[model samples]
Target: MAKKGDMLYAWTNDAEIKKHAELGGAVTGLWKFALESKAVDAVLVITKGTDLYDAQPVLISDPKELAKTAGSLHCGTLLMPKLIKNYFDGAANMKIGVTVKGCDAMAFYELAKRKQINLDNIIMIGVNCGGSVSPVRARKMITEKFGVDPDTVHKEEIDKGQFIIEYEGGHKGISMDELEEAGYGRRTNCRRCKMKVPRQADLACGNWGVIGDKAGKATFVEVCSEKGANLLEGAVKKGIIATEPANPKGLEIRGKVEGAMLKLGEKWRKKDFEGLGEGKDRLKKIMTETSRCIKCYSCILACPICYCVDCTTKNPAYVKPGELPPSFMFHLIRYAHIADSCVNCGQCEELCPAEIPNALFMHAQQVELEKMFGHVPGVNMELPLMAYVEEKQERARLKNTGSDMIYENVFNPVLKN
Candidate 1:
């Protein structure tokens, strides 16, 4: 049986699953095993909607429906952690096996830090992510860059430094460098993301470096915790999946590939932030850009860190209600509350109605905060510089001392996903 930190090449024993799965069916097999063995009450995954660009999250309890959820969806932009918090009680009441990208995994830790979710009951199976594309931009790229009908494209992937697609009668690939040069690749936040692999999850799996006979038919999985070890060893014992030690050469290749991606991320971070100018110039740009906000609250809602049910912005004491282009205070509330912990998930920018680069501004602030305080937001359970404190402490402060200070700002009780 594999132990935590073990890296293996794994594949499904089920042929039917193999037919529909990508790289390998091991992830799908794991989900099936988890459900059938009562290890988890349900599995959460993404399913295709109308076309390759239409990705939606589905919660499944029946193992029979697991096959359709196999494979990656690079066009998918949904944040999985928030869905669990909003719809599934943060997996607090029920055990769940859910696939997660780096951002999703990090968000879970951040939420757990705030006591919004029960991390002990949730099983996170992380996937290595190069990045994700916006749906609208994806469709346009397929039509114009790939020279094919977007609807005809049935599958897509980022592989060997290229964005590839398989259409009805043909398949084509274009270098990511080329696409991004033309301003049509991954989102700005994704371009600068450094979380290529989520070691914080129970198990981190991807098709990064499976080689030789198993090249296209296996997943490279790194067991990250005791929970992952137990789950993987259980699946193998049950004959639901098979495994072999990872190839040393493949491991070397994987390191190089990951290093290249990291360097690229650094390159993009420099370009994106430097273009905004330094210090005061950058803050000026952010304020000027956010001035157009129609008080939609979309950014606040989309953020994974804004966990207060009675939002501080609506306190009416800090930010007056019914104010158009709400005061700079609206933006300040977000900056103060979320800047130290922003995960750079890109949801705010994606959902913004006014086209503000909210992720860019927030991430820039997070970077600056990281430099000042040496606090990396979501890599672990470590509390931020602005600590997350339980709410009962706040109530006791008011009751015993009769002080109505109301908030420490940083210690607000958070809802975990």
Candidate 2:
């Protein structure tokens, strides 16, 4: 039987699944098995809506419908965790199997810590993420940079430091560095994200290190939990999938690849944060940028860290309604409440109407908070010790009823009990 910490090169036993799925179909095979065996009530997946750029999330109830969710839609930048929280009763009522990127996995934990999600009922299968390009930006990059119509593109891959696309006639690739330098690569938040592999999930699957003959023909899966080990062993025993021990060489290579990604993340973080500057300088930049906010609450509604039925931002005691651009308090409230727990999912900035660097500012503060308080969000199930006592109870209460006023002691936080 498979066990936690085992790394295996895995692929599907089914010919059709093998033919269609990217990198051996291990992830798709696991989801299909879960659905067919009733291991999960549904598998939440992203599928094409209109074109390659139009990635929509769907809840697949039947194993037969799994084919539509097969393959990769790297352009589909949607987060799966919030959908579970908002639509599926936070997976509290039904067992859910989901494929998550680093951000989605991180968000899941954050929501779970906030008591917005019931994690025991959900199976999280994490995929390694380099980053994702915005659908619109991807289309534009294809047309203007790749010199091809977006519709004609059959597949897109970010491999070997290049953004490669297979079109109707032929495939073309351009160095990601070239594209990013020219301002047309991954989302700004993605560039700075260091969560390359979400070991927080039960299984962390990726095509990063299936070397030798298995290269490009299998997924490298690291069994991260007993749940993952059980699922993998079951699939192998049932002939739903096949697996072999991962190569030691492949493991070494994977480590190097992850190191490179982390270094890149730090580089971007330094650049982004340095530009924002210190204290009053950063505050001034934030205030100036937020002055354009129409207070549409797109960022608030979309932020995975935010899950209040009655939002404090809308509380009239703090924020005066009908004020154009709102007040600095509006933005401060968000920074105060979210900065401690922000997973930097990029949803806030992605959905912002004013194109504010919302994630950048939030992440910048999160780093500062991490240094000062030693609380890192979404890395584990542990409640942040800084807020683990009476504050956690009050925060949990405020999530539903909300305070008529912001808590006064938010700044002078008590040490964890």
Candidate 3:
């Protein structure tokens, strides 16, 4: 930890960074600062390819390359394990910088608890998540709406209750509010998210609702730890950037997003977080919804936490070639496996071409699991809550099987009936 009052700079996605002798544009100022900071041994940014001209998450040492990958810094979520593996593989001992979302940061926290990475030497820059889109679906939309040629599409977003798809050749917008919009940018995992802010992060940054000023300059920054504060402070003291209070509108937007999630949580509470119906009905729904799947294995690739040496789907011992759906059991088993650990990031649902809404399913189950266990998966690192530990203290915290609760007030009143 660098301690409080260290060098730091923060900004929204709209903030532009003037590079060495190059024209300035919207860039993740932190990445630019890291590039300028010769003290940093290496910089690892986990961002999307499309965001910065399809730049991958890798080491960017040269200033020019840093500029090219600057768009990646705006990404709200970057799966943690991939970046960690990159560091471990390189065997880099020097102070390194990496980006992660709230859930991904929590994933790192879990891994750190298990002694997976050395957190002392690393710089964790976090971003508050709005959501994410599957690259495959994004490409599909481009291809279907405006031809697959990269030159055709210029920009994309969900605007004014419509999907605004802009192109160099021509532009067209679809009313997402009207259409049966599924897949791609519509993140299913985000629907059940309760935490949008990065709690365990050293530094948190995002755009969410923060746009630049009339001068087109807005900065989104949150210092969660001593090192993060120091980084931003150093940047300001060194005259690299200016600081201002976050926009009040940003806080209002944050509240709305949080409120929406809380409402969803309340709905689940009313449902008792139980299965929709009996075993047959629930299984039938799963089968019918999953029937559309052709087993493209895209979800497995997008999933941040699904890591197995060799997946059973690929193993000859478990699966054979030319299997259309690969058995509903595989889907159910895989869902159950990741259910407890799922952070509700929504990548699986976003990536699935079949649009199965597995993310929502996970979210519903997550509520139930949380109610049952009184645990939030990766919130607290000091105490091991997700993993089962024998403790008399926890027994009281666990949900009772209805038989455990005493019927004192309600039951006595019902005797009159």
Candidate 4:
């Protein structure tokens, strides 16, 4: 039987699934097993859209339809938790199996904390993410940088610091660094993201470890919790998949990969934040950037953490309906409400018609709060700093308290600040 904290190399035993899946099809096999064995009522997945560049989230109840969601799409940028909470009745009624990237997993944790989702009825399968490309940007990159027709591309993969693409005749690969230098690559928020592995999820699966002959043919799976272990053991017992202990070298390699990605992320963070200047300069930069906003509310709609049914943004006193470039209060209200919970998913910035760097500013605010209160959002079930200090006395104490004093007085100081 699978055990919590067990790390193994696994693959789908089914030939068709192995052939169609990105890496050994272990994820697809597990989803199929969950549905056929009644472990879950439905599987939520992203399927290929009109073309290889498009991806659409779908809910599949039939095992036969699982194949359509086998492969990965780097251009698929939707966050699944909001859909589960807002559209699927918070998944309170049906058991579900869903795939998650780092952001999606964090969003799930935040939603669970707010009682928006029934975590008892959900199975989270975490996937490793380097980053995702915007569809429009990806098309342009292919056409100009790769000198290939974007429509002719059939497949894409990001590996070893390169963006690889495959078409009918052959394939081409470009250095991701080169692309970013040319003003094209992963989303800005993604480049600064440090969470490459979604360890918070039940099962963390990826191809980061396998090497040599097994390099592209197997998946490295980390059973993170009891629920994840049960799913793996059950699938194995039912002959849905095969597993073996992961190679020590594989695990070491995976650590090195994660370390390298984090280092690069740190570099990007410094570069991106440096432009904001400091003190009054930073405030001026923020004001200048947000002044372009046309009050489309696209950022609010795209945010996974925004759950208020009757939002203050809709109220005339706060944001004034039908006003163009609505007052700075509009953006300030959003920052204050979500700064503690923002997961840096980039949806807000990506969806903004004004092209404001919503995620960047929010993330900057979150970093400051993290320093002041030592609270990192979406990592666990803990309530945000604002949640605990709703009372006027608590707010007054917090305002007057020094960072070190706050760290020593209220919460665990041993935690990262």
Candidate 5:
């Protein structure tokens, strides 16, 4: 059996699956094996919808139906964990195998910690995500920048710092930096996100480490958990897939690639948050940005962490209904509730009609909470920072806290003269 941390080069033996899959159909083959072997009751995956730009999440119970979910959709910005939580009752009734991007895996981890989903009943297949583009924006970019019909585009990929598109007769490529400079690249949240590999998941699989003769023909699979190892071993033993030890050089290159992506993300984080400034300047900026909120509640609705049945934003005591430009209390309540658990998933900002940089703000707070408590959200099953504080006095103070307490107690402690 494969052990945790074992890296292997693997590919599907099914020619049809290989032809349609992004990288040798290893994920597809694994899902097929899981279903046929009755290892999972269903497979949750994203599939191309009406057009290549429109991607939808699907739950497949039959192995034969896995083909429709093959291929990668970089334009798919949907988070699958929320779907499982809200629609499927956290998959409590079934065993599931699901594909996850870094954000999805993180969100799932947070959900599991809250007992919303039973992690033991699920298999998570992690995909290495460079980033994702907003579909509507991507379509416009393809038509205007690439001089191609967005509807006719066959495939899109980000590699070697370029956004490449394949069409009927030819292919075109443009540097992502150039595109972003022209206001057309990955979503701002994705650009700043450092989590490229879903290391928290069962198996992390991608094309990053498959090189030399196996380049583009096999997937680099990192077994992150015993569950992942078992799935891979079972697939190989069942003759559904083939595997070989990954090349050491290829593994090194993969690490370098991830490092570069993380470095780029750090640069983005600095660029995006630098304008917030410090002290009153930062407070003023946040207040100014949030003042534009029409209280549409889109951010709260789209948030994976905000699962409270009686949300504070909806409570009249905190925020009056039909209030335009909702009270700052609404925003404050949300930040306090979700900052420790925010996974920087970008859904809130994406769904916000006011275009508030919700992810950036929440992530900034999450970073602070992390440093203060050494609790990194979504990387593991660890409880949130507030969970460990057992002092009743401190809890009472926290319950009665206001915005000033953050600067006084958290950000800048008052020193006695």
Candidate 6:
């Protein structure tokens, strides 16, 4: 993960990159950094695609480059990890700087542990997330509600009080009161996502007071790791990100949902591993659910990992030309092959037309694997179960007692205990 002249660059958003790096300040309580800080040689800012909320990752080695690309924008987690990997792979020997949302950082962590990329030399910057919307859905919502083409709407903005939709004709603002009463605006993923502390990050940054408080104008930033702390100390010494601990009000603004996610994560974390359906019966359940799969292979394309040269589904092996649903065996075999390594990211479920909870099935399979083989798939930095040579005892663990295969491995009349 390290090499000569490598600088890990990261960004919170376009506004953060330009305003903070250029003025020697920090944005939204993110750590402040002076362009002169040697601890961070460069910065990479991500920007919202022109006319789109989805931001494409951008790398900046020079302060000038940082200023140019940074500006007002939104961050979308869906494409962030893919963008990070794309940039990291191209950098190769040189260390790169980058920023990621909570889920993106988790995905990166999972990938890094698997040795997909060496991230030790990379700098990680993290941002607190409120989640984001799909462009298609957002546009459709605006068009239906506001009676205007969403793309023609001059601007759309979100603030503590309301969601403001500004059009060429006029602007309409939806108050937080209304949004709450109407049960609108928040993304579904946020309801399920539990990571809030940025506990896995090096630095956590944000603008705590500025959103609702006009008088005070400091960003709320916390150093979550030694590397982040050292960088912040350097910035503070140089008067770049100068501040004291923020008021406790920001936490209140985050309110019940953040607390709910934290509670859910804690609750799930404490559950006994044995309670996760990690038995042969559990494995059978997974196989049964997968049997409903119609060889759609949509899951393969949805997966970030199944990056094969040519998938078997497309080859002459199983699929015939113009087949209706391919074959059920294709999906069943794929589940068996990839379930051990699956991270349960839920992409397959998200993309499934049948609304099958493929991720849940994979999660159950992973639980079974963890119980029997002592493997947890993508989370561990150590080698995967499939990577290891199976000991005689280990192989015997899979066979049912009284079965022929079990008898072959375990039975000896002279040695029976």
lDDT values, one for every candidate: 0.89, 0.88, 0.55, 0.87, 0.86, 0.52
Model 4 worst lDDT window (10 residues): 402-411
Q: Which candidate is the best by lDDT?
A: 1
Q: Which stretches of candidate 3 lie over 4 Å from their true place?
A: 1-16, 19-27, 35-40, 46-55, 72-80, 86-94, 139-151, 158-163, 169-185, 208-215, 247-254, 257-280, 287-336, 347-361, 382-417
lDDT score, candidate 5, position 416: 13
What TM-score would every model get versus the actual structure? 0.95, 0.93, 0.67, 0.92, 0.91, 0.63
Off by over 4 Å in 6: 1-44, 68-77, 84-87, 90-92, 154-164, 169-188, 207-216, 249-257, 261-302, 305-324, 333-417
- Over the stretch 1-417, how does candidate 3's per-residue lDDT look in tens digits? 234422222332223344321112222455556567763666776544644224366776664465445543222434655456444642236666776666777666555544445577677777655444455555665566445564466555543335566576677766542332343343445434556667577776655445445122343566678777767666656555556665567667655755664675454434423444536776677678887777888777666545543465564434556788777766775666566666676667766778886766665666666678676666766534434432233344332522212222234455324
**Residue-level lDDT for 392 in candidate 6:** 42
Model 6: lDDT equals 0.52
Report the lDDT tens digits of candidate 1 across residue range 131-198: 99999999998888889999888889999989999989989999999999998889989999999999
Preferred candidate (TM-score higher): 1 or 5: 1
Index of the highest-TM-score prediction: 1
Better of 3 and 5 by lDDT: 5
Candidate 5: regions farther than 4 A off:
387-417
lDDT of model 6 at residue 334? 66
Every candidate's CA RMSD? 4.1, 4.0, 10.7, 7.6, 5.9, 9.4
Model 1 misses residue 331 by how many Å? 0.8
Candidate 4: residue 186 Cα off by (Å)? 0.5
How many backbone clashes does every candidate have? 3, 0, 17, 0, 0, 18
- Name the TM-score of candidate 3: 0.67
Model 6 C-alpha lDDT per residue in residues 1-417, reported as the tens digit of each score: 212221122223334443534212353223225344544444555655677555466655555455445333442335344444555562346555566566556655555654445566556666655445445556666776556677776556555545677777888877634543344553433323455544456676544333344223444455666766666556555544454444456545444545755675444433423343556765565556555656666777656545443455665445565565555556665666566666545567656666666766655565567678786543335666443433344445644354223233344554345
Window of ten residues with lowest summed lDDT in model 6: 1-10
| Per-residue alpha-carbon lDDT of candidate 5 for residues 1-417, written as tens digits (9 for 90 to 100) | 699989999999976686688778999999999999988999999999988888999999988888778889989899988888888889898899999999999999887776677788889999999999999889989988999998778888998889999999899999999998898989988998889999888999999978999998899999999899989999999998999999999999999999999999988888877867878888888899999998877787778787764465776756878888888999999889899889999999888878888888998888778889798888888898544443344446755764212223433444211
Please, what are the lDDT tens digits per residue for candidate 4 over residues 202-240? 999999988866788888899999999999999899898
